[model samples]
Every structure is written in structure tokens, then in C-alpha cells.
Target: MPQITMSAPMSKFSSFNVHDDFVYKNVDGVAIKTAILVPKSLKPGKKAPVLVHMHGGGFMTGNRLFEPWFALWFMQWAESVGAVIVSPDHRLLPESSSEDMADDIVDFWSWVHTDLSAEVSRVTSGATQVDLENIAVGGESAGQYSFRAQLSITNHEIGGFLSVLSALTCPNAKIKAVVCQYGPLDYEVPWFTQPNHQRSIMGAPPAEPGKPEAVIQDYLTRYVDVEKIAVRTESRVEELWPLCVAYAHAGKLAEALGRSDKVMPMRLIEKAESLPPIWFVHGSGDTIVNPDCTMNFVNKVKKLLPQTPMHVSMEPGEHGFDGGVPLDEKWVQDGLSQTAAMSSKPGEQFEVRQTSTTEDYTPDPSKSLPLSPERQALVDDILALYSCQPTIRRVERYTADCVYDDQFVYANDRYKMAGQWFALPKFFKESKNERYEIIKNDRDLIQFKNEQSWTFKLIPKTATINAIVSLSLDPDTVDSDFIQVKYHKDQANDKDYSHNGFGFQFKKFQADNVVKLMSSDEVKYFEKDKHAAKEPVKKYGTGDETGQAPKQDF
Candidate 1:
């Protein structure tokens, strides 16, 4: 556990400017440290939204300045959205209680609100920046507990010991959003399976063997002192306990008594009706804090505050999504590639096209062709293209006919239906002979669907395509679908590329026809004649007629 020492100020992106080692003091008069990052190009006179972030360390160890990735990712996001990020380091445990930890957070907020108001005001006034109304708080692991405590103080639920400082310091404080990443919400659950029973059998703290009944008696007698114990014993007549001498030991008695009903009891704090939106991210494979803890807490919170927007992302990694399993550089690379592909410059679009030689042309509505070896190979290749690794599951797939489907299964799993397009790659290496014609084109549309799905529409000379994909278990069946492939292509230009793309709707029991097409030219040709009268192309586009090439997925 090396202490965090700030070396040099670094910038993550061009827009994000960071300052390291910003120190602030807590109410206890401890000099706590923090890292502050601000977006450089903000409009003058506007209060920008700010995010206060806490790092995860199981409540025992961690520093804001040391783990720069947490601040870096947050600052990058803030800069992208023109917001500010503040990350603070709180005092660690053994020296601090949960109460003291909560107090430290409130103190940090107080300093930001009052002591640093001039800096905030300068940043906001000099540039039309910062939406003061839209402040957010977030943390990972033990830090999440602190953030939760902050929310509890805001809701007036069992007022945190630090609430007084918060009221005096940041009376106008209002958090718009909260994000918790793999945090422990409950403490009472024992270190072993049967905590309570084990405690009783183990005979309390400073626990030693052969000291059961003696420990209990000494604990009870010390509250009234030795004289009272002797008087009671004399009246009872017969027995004089040999282990009674330990009763006079105040430290032992205190430790024994402290282990009584107070240690790690399950407690719930009632939330306000207008609680802020919450975002939770955890790993399903997390062995440390069970993912159920997050869902359970969310359920309880929603029961009290139904309107609070809650979102959860259970990634493939283990606890903290960093440790345990060996890190997969390919997964990291793929994520980076996807992120880069999603972010396109203004007026630029990326395009992809896929073609196959074995169409065996079938346009007849009622005809069904027997599977040939080549056709079967084509089908296998296409299916193989959609397959994912054990780590990567297919959560959803959408077809062109506005129908969603996920019928494919591997390793006792099936996918769900999503309306947006997404892509999920298999972890296993593809065979040399296996091939699937897949043309996925992506462009940043003005508006996008929240869920994974597929969309296709014909423009005057082009067709708009969109899809959403994700990795999630099937809601109906608890089957694993870790990968999602969403394909959307913009076909506004009547360009002739010898490619064929087919879409299908699949179910657990039956396969349904969605849309199967050979080329965009054929799609356009079908739209031309009244005699043809094919399915009318849906009217959906960003309304910007400028033809931008679709993004190609590599």
C-alpha cells in the first residue's frame, strides 16, 4: 500500500485540463487531499455541472491522486460534456469509523461549496460555464458508502453526524445524480457464514479458549462492579465463580460488551421521495461483494423513491472490474475501438460493406430451397460470425422488420430482444474455412434509441440504418448472452456494391422472416414501381441530407 504522491499534472484529452494534489481539510481538522479537473472551453457566466468522485479501496486504503485512472476517466467524460470533476481522498479505517468517514466527505463538500466558492465563481463567471443545479456525486467500493451517507444526509434520514457541518457549509447543496460502483451497503453479515452464532460461541472479543461462561459472567457483573456481584452471590449462597477476578478488568469488560448486539447490525436508511438518479456498475462475476447487494439496495430505494432513474451495468470482469481474473488485452482493445468508432468528428460518417458469392437467388414468396453444402456453409459462417466467447454473451439482436430476436444458444445460453443495433465478438478463434458476409456501417445519428435494436429506412437516394447492442442475460430466461451485435447502415447514395445483407427474427421455438436483401440497389428498385408495391420503407432519419459515409467496424 504505497501512499499516493502527485508527480506532474497531466491532461487526458485536449478539452480536459487537470490540476493534481489539491488539498482540503476535513471537519476534524485533518488535511485531506483532492484532485480537481476542469474543462477549459466553457461559456462565460454559466454554472457548469460538477461531479464529486470517490475511489474504491474496501474502506481500508486508497488515494485520489494515486489511482489517476478514476479521475482521468471522470475528467474525460466531464470535459466531453462540459462539466467539472472533483475527486477527494478520505481517511482510512482502523483509525476511522464509518461515522468519521462520512464526516470527512461532508467536510469536503463544505469546502467546495464555501471555501472554494471564489474559484468556482471565477470559472463560472469568466466563462458561461457550470450548471450549479446539476451536481452529481459518485464513488466506488467503500467510497460509495460515503456517497450513500451523503445522500442519506440530504434526505434527512438519521441525520449523519456530519450533517451539521454540511448544513452550515453547503445549505444549498443538491445532488442531481449518484453513481455507485461495486459498493458494500450492508455490514452486519458476518465474516463467516453464521456470524451471530459464531460470536456467541466464540465468547466475545479478546476471545480465548476455555473462557465461555466466565467471559459472560464477567461481562454482566462489571457493569454493577465487584461488590454488587459479591452481594448477589452471597444471597444466592452456594457457588463462588473462579473466573470472577476478570470482572474488574475494565478493558476486557468493554471489549466483551462491545461485541453485543451493536457489531455489524443490518440497518436501512429511508430515502426521500425525490431522490436523485442513480447509476450502478458492478461485475456479475464479482466474488467480493455479491452483485445481489447492489440490486437489493436499488429495489429498496426504488420502493421508496420510484421516480429515481436507476441504471446498472454488470461487466464481465471481477470485483472492481480490475482484479481477480487475468486481464484480457483484447477486450480492452475492443472496447477502445468501439469507443473510438462511436465518437466521430462533425459531418463525418463511417461506412462498412459485406458481400458473399453464394446467394442462390430466391425471390419466390412460397418457395423453400433444400440446404445445399455451400448454402449450409454460408449459414454456418453467418452463425459463426454472430457467436461469442464464454466471456462475451449476446444479449440482444434486432432485425429490419422492427422485430427483435435472440434464438442462438451456446454453453446453455440464449439472448434477448433489443431494438437498437450492437456488435459482440466471440472469444474463440474462428476456423480458417468459416466465413460470414457481414457489412456493419455506423454513423452518429442526431437521435438514438436507449436499448439495442435494429432500424432501416429509405432516404430519397440513401437508406438510414441503426442498431443497438449490449451484453446482458436474457430477462425471461437466466441464460448468458455476453455479446451483442447491432448493425445499422445508411444507404442514401444509390451506390452499387456487390454485397448482400440479410436480417432474420429468431425465437426459441420458431424462426420468423424479418427482411432479407441482397443489395441496396435492389431495395431502391423495389421502392420505384407502383406495380411492385413492396413494403413501404419507414420514414426515420436525422433529417440532415448531407451524405456522410457509414463507419466500418474493424
Candidate 2:
């Protein structure tokens, strides 16, 4: 067992008190830390539900404390929902393997149940207690793996093959609900096995026996070992049997790596009946993790546990969409509220609710329209100059014209600007400074605002702007290139944006093919009657990403 220590609440914010310190570790003395948010409104004798959230970093890097905006975002959420939020620090790769990280989570969570519950008085001084009956665990990206491992290992402890075969009784690690945001539930899927994804999470690749890159070699060795086990699954190879088999084998590998269970979640589906309700939130435009990953997991879980209460929110934005702007602040609050609400009851199930929101970049180009190639080229040229690049990547071209309506608000003033190519420079000049500086320009969004704040006026003034871009196949007569811009000014002489804020959705367009509802009743019926008669939709990707064998990228 690893040592456990916790610090006192760091801040005296009105709604919650924040605390940070190491929670648990392995025999190797590698300690994992936690940032806890405890609501102040709780009665001294009563207990509060616990939410153990893991941060997103593709399993390679990330921490409990994020950037300024996200930090405030988490704190405000804890304050708003009035729950005990525990964000544990999982060790990153190179220094720790996936197995080791998962072990840390299990150990940390176990310690929370036994040790922390006993010593709750030490941290809270008996003012608050941790409701041991209700515990919700969740994360984003790599963090989601932590939840899977925590649940899997805990499930195994309660009564999986080893426990049942050995006739051992393990204490139940109570979990009330789960919240997963933009995470992959299936690692064996080809999307993750690719060189790029592998490099990001498993480290630079080309793993072989006795390779110089020891980390990559170890990861590959473990992965190969799991693959071999997956091939031996007794059930149909294409079904969930293979996925569960691979995870079971991963549990063996985890032990070899000095841990408890694998960082895979497919096996957990089999135990859905024993698990709590789940909530999933994802961005449709997330390419890094792919929305399909979440969609697939949700679909599988639904098929396995159809009557299980589940909630999903698919919004239009890139990764980390819930943060970064004011409009999204509501989305974050909704997610947090859902988590708190779900955790309120330990045994009851809720109905499944699927909700989604899209920005100006509608898939239906006929409504918003596109610009001609020549016109788009000119817009791209302007953006290239602003981005300080010679030319924009053609592969990153945008086809939809900008949607400039009442979506933009600056210091209480609401104005609509048309023609994104032309509105951009004009909006730049609206700043207190005569000229605006373009900080970042990418295919997804563009960031620009005032530049003279650093010079220091008698009363300093500044602003930061972000514009989410929209692309179409080819623009013919579209006049505007602007989509939606969230502009904020520190001293803009207006009340609406005296602080920082964001906005979107000037005009609503029906979801295009890519982001349309897949699990809807009509779609499912259509698939069952029309599509099921036909062949399965062929999945495709460039190069070896076509779900074939691993492409050796040594």
C-alpha cells in the first residue's frame, strides 16, 4: 500500500474551498496528487457526494490545474454544483506506463474509500464528510482510461473471474455515475493504433524486441501480448467478445508492469449491469480523438444496457469546446449539473437524453452557401498574411461563407458584420489600438485582438478575439467568409464585454451529413430496414490507417 496525505483547503471562495496535495502512490514512491473542491454550503455533520475527475492529455501529459480559464471554470463548477470534486493527478508516460497510471488511480480511489473516509476529519476538520456510498469517476481523453481501469479493477475486486474462482469476498467500491468527455473507449480500434495517435500516447513508436527506445519497446511488447490474447477469444471475432478478451489479457500485462488492470474499457461493458448510470459529452468536430469513438462506445453500452439511464451532449466545436468562451460556459455548467444530479441517487436509473448544438458551420451548404475558389483564395491569402504564413494549407480550406449577425456583442453594443474577409480587418481596427495583431490563425479558428496593451496607457486596455472558421466544398456566390467570433475587451467602454466573453449561432443551419443524428429513431429504423439489407458501410482512411495491420513507422 502507498502512503496517503492531503492538504487543507487552499482558498476561501464563497461557495467552495479548494485543496491540493498528494493522495496515493505505488511501492516505487511515485506519489499522485489531487486538487479537491469542497462546497462551503454543506452542513458540518452531513456528507457530500464525491466526483473524481481526470484531466485530458492523450495519456501523455496533463495535470489537475489547467490554464487560467479552465482553472476558474472548474472552481466555478464546483461552487455552482456544491459537490466535492477531486481531480487526481495520474503520472504521465515515459515516467510511468499505462498500467502503472491505472494502478495509481485504483490505489488512489481505494485509499479515498478506506483511508480518506476514515481521516475525513483531518482534511475537513469534521466540518464535512465524504459520502462513501456515492462516488462518481470520470475523465477526458486519457483520463477516461483511468475511469475504465478504476471501474474494471474495482469490478474485478468485487467479483470477476479471479475473485469468483478464488472464492474471495472484496469490498464494494461504490460508484454512482460516470462522466466521459471526448474520450476513446476502444484502444484496439485502428484510429488509436496509427503512428500519430500511438506516438502521442504511447510515445514515439516502432516498437520491437530489444529496441533502443525502451518505452516504445515496452508499450509494443505489452500491446502485442494483448493482441495475441484477443485473437484467442472464444466468441465471434467481430463481436464484443474480442474486445473483452483483449482487456482481460491487458489485466495480465498490467500485473507484469507492476499494476492491477489494463487501461481498456470494453470489458466494462459486460459488467454494465453492475455499473452506475453514465453521461457522455463530446465535440462533433474533434478529429484528434474522433467523435466516432464516443459514438461507438455509447452505442455499445446502449445495446448492452438499453434500459440504463444515459445522457449525451454532442456540440459543434473542437476539443475543449466547453471551455475557452462564455457561451460554452453554460455547456460546462450543464455537464457539471448532470454529473451532480446523476450522483445524487446511488441506485436509481434515469432516462436517456441525447442533446446537441451546432455553430454557424452547418453541414448543409445550400443554406449558408460557399464562395468560389478564386474568392476563397483571396480570403485565404488575407488569413495567410494575418497568420504570418506564406500560404494556407489547401487541405484546410473552408467552403462556407461567414455568418455575421447579432452573434457578436462588444461592451453592450450588438452589431452584425458581413463578409468575414472584410469584417476581420474592420473589427481589428475597432480595438482601442489603431491596429490589431493576429496571434493565431488555423483551419479551425483564428485569434486576433488589440496589440497596444503592453505599451501601458494611463488606464490599460486590451481585448482578445477568437473566430471559429467554416469550410465548404466550393463557394460559388457566397459573399462572407466570417463564421462566429467571440470578442472580449478589458476597457472597451461597454457593459456586455467589459469582461471577457464569447458568442455564436447567428443563423441556424440543419446538420449536414457528417454531424447528423445517427442513433435517432428514424435513422435506426432506416438502418434496420433499408441499410441492414445492404452491405455494411465500408470504413476508410488514408494509407495504412484503413484498419489493417500496424504500419511500421520506424
Assess the local accuracy of residue 393 in candidate 1 as a C-alpha lDDT between 0 and 100. Answer: 19
Question: What is the overall TM-score of model 1 with all chains considered together?
Answer: 0.40
Clashes of each: 53, 13
Per-model TM-score, in order, reads 0.40, 0.43
Give the least accurate 10-residue stretch of model 1, judged by summed lDDT.
Answer: 152-161
* lDDT of candidate 2 over 70-157, digit per residue (tens): 3334444344333577766665543456555555566666677777665556678878777766665655322111222322100111
Report the lDDT of model 2 for residue 445. Answer: 34
Candidate No. with top lDDT: 2
lDDT of the candidates, in the order given: 0.35, 0.39
Deviation in angstroms for 521 in model 1?
18
